[model samples]
Target: MDARDRDGPDRDGREADFTWGQARDFANQLIQAHSGKHLTDLEIKVLQGSWQNHTYEAMAEQYTYGAGYLNRDVGNALWKKLSQALGEKVSKTNFREALRRAWWQQGRSVPSVPPSVPPSVRPSVLPMTPPLPAVPLAETPFAEGPVAPQSPFYVVRSQVEDLGLRSLLKPGALVRVKAPSLMGKTSFLYYLLQGVQLQGYATIYLDLGSIDRDILTDLGKLLRWLCARVSRQLKIPNRLEEFWDSDIFGSNDNCTAYFEEYLLQEVPQPVVLGLDNVDRLFPHGAVVEDFFGLLRSWHERARISTLWQQLRLVLMHSTDVYIPLDYNQSPFNTGVPIELVEFSPDQIQALALLHHCSLDRPALAQLMAAIGGHPYLVRRALYELGTGSQTLGQLLATAATETGIYGAHLRRQWLLLQQNPALWQALIQVVQGTEPVSLSPLTLYKLHSMGLIHRHNNRVMPRCTVYRDYFRSMHRADSP
Candidate 1:
């Protein structure tokens, strides 16, 4: 018998002689061939662990280190080798795909293809061909699992570049990006910062999500933190100490005055300040108003300053917190409000390509339709598809249930609706009525701001079918 038959039959009864070392060597050879860099012993070990589909936590446990440490070390080591080989930096997450491709190259059995699309729902467009190269595994920087490539995490091209979002970084422009959780808000901000830096603008990314209402009570400290963060990011010399020693944080007015006079005016390059999760600052209106007013004041001063327009601000937030300023007057409202909508068909296709999935047009369309373009939902559905076991109908039904990413988000919203019956009533009226019921202006505004309903043709409408059905079910169950 051949060596393959001598070893044993795989679960499928096919002759196989696959061993752990064989898998490692196969992965190494593939990396060498594609990446042109030799893997270190540590990297090979990590790759072997990864090839076995071990979690970072598990790897850490095996190595007696923290998961984060193992992840970072392995990630950095992989990135170093990939950069040396490819002559460009490859992100940590994409490395997983490289390993998968290596397995395929080694004559190992490939995962089964997903079932064919139903004839009734075939796509109008032809299938995308393989001429488009697969995104090298080492280049993707997100985590690996059976996630759909169409998910937001997969759609992130790299840390420093995303052509779709580059325009938001123009000097002195205001931009607002909104999405629900796991839609890649933080990742997008990182990309935007990288983009702005490439354009010779300085960037400071602040996560206001961690700040509380009490922080707003001390506006001086807030401004000081902002100034120091900007200074450090820009490599401005001793910026925090300079501001502190100069008494910038002594009082609210002192901080604002110093920001307008020194940091804003004296900065060497155009500044792009990204305030992520700005909704946390909203509960303290005084702080929010003051902080934004400082930005507006500096923006006006920018036109007259000897330096180029000095500063721009981008605010990222979820739908929970509302910004009460009028669009025309507010700095965030003045420039452009770009709602990072759900993934487009092309983006989803890009994801499939990245994951090396053989998704045809009809299959792609069916996936998008079921998820309603929500990013996390799309990812979860694509993940299910990647497994090549579940049916499209099963994936679609799960997309609506509470088990997948989309379902979890829906459950959160459903629970919120249950807590606030007025909100529930408002949603029901908007969904079931042919004409928009005239809700109290405050209620209408609040719901719209919360993303529960959207205005269309002077009428409020429910945001999604899931929400509509939720209220409909409640309404029916209550009927007696």
Candidate 2:
């Protein structure tokens, strides 16, 4: 067989097994050369899935995106772009045939397609993410699982409260989120990240709490590890050797330059890097200061350079306590600071309803009085109540006791306080007093940082009745 005859079936066979990697390459070249626009990751996913005789529903299942979004939004936009490039109308339904004909006219292979069922005969499929079976909404408590951004249990009354986080998607725009633990800071960050996911952005969620103590103990290694991990999460090949210049440039500068030159180039769209548990770095004096300084510079760089704008930051920390970096060099002092407080009574009621609790307004208010609308505690109480594992009265009664519903949580806090006797004693004075007590600034900072005390002006008090009652009993019974 001559070259033309020999190549026909082989080209058709390759089309039958056509995959995402192939479609992405061709679509990228075509669109970039024609319209100067590159196909997004989700768009490429849609293209290959569509070419394989997959309907939007099937493609959505494969891509873990909404079918309507895939069909009405991405699919329509994609076909429009292809039509503009190919100079003919193209669509998901006849994509293979159209592509074949187009390729024929252009003297290219017909990337035909695999044998597959027609759209009419296609069975409904579930997404790659396993979903809970349909049940009474309340019985499937929102507290029992990772709350989706759209989950009814996850409440957001207004966008104004989020400090434009949802809308501030530009590169280098930094959002500093501060809240005591369990105040829904992470959940709020998740809401923000989910918003970007719908807009075809890449996001990385790194909890510094997950960082190894070994790395945290040293500055140089920590920065290298962080750069490596962020690169890995972005699916970009790490070129640490090319970026690191520890002997000449400082570690922070090297890390910053790496992201600017190598890392940012690999990302197709804007990036949202979420640094959770920022307090984890607070103990490492020099490292924390320099690292935050680097972050501050990154945010500032966005103001001047267009490329730096692709690196938006959302930093979440659990305390007001900060390492004393120059005010100008600390990302904490600038940028939008979002402080998440406990849920309000109305929010608590909404949560209860979402949890399927049969609580009246008075009962919810009573629970709010007992737990002060703390997200984790409120959700825990509602979960147990909704599941019939505990009554509201039963929860309230045990909440302050060592063996109560919050036993593990309370114990963890108490243990942390025990490690710092000064903090423990200051908490004692705050807990036992009729009103707020004055403590040393560092002591007060520590207590507030633990989410165990409320600080205002120069005085401190137990954060809630649960903390007061539990610690008051412990303080009175223990050695003076």
Q: Measured by C-alpha RMSD in angstroms, how accurate is candidate 1?
A: 14.6
Which sections of candidate 2 miss by over 4 Å? Answer: 1-146, 157-161, 164-167, 320-332, 436-444, 455-461
Clash counts for the predictions, in order: 8, 2
lDDT of 2 by residue, 1-480 (tens): 343222222353443333333344445545655775556556766876775566888887776789999989889999999888777887877555555444444423222322475645432321111111123754465454335555545655343333545445555788888876667777787878766665778989888888899988788888898899899999888899988988999888889889988998888799988887887887667778788888898889888988898888888886633423222333358787777777766566556655666565467657877778778888888888878888888888889989898887887777767766766777787877897788877666666766787776688777788888998777777867
Model 1, 246-310: lDDT tens per residue?
Answer: 43344445555556667767677777878888766655666777877766665566557644356
What is the RMSD, in Å, between candidate 2 and the native fold over all Cα? 17.6
lDDT of 2 at 17: 38
TM-scores for all candidates: the values are: 0.60, 0.65
List candidate 1 stretches off by more than 4 Å.
Answer: 1-125, 128-171, 179-182, 237-252, 260-267, 323-332, 356-358, 418-420, 430-464, 470-480
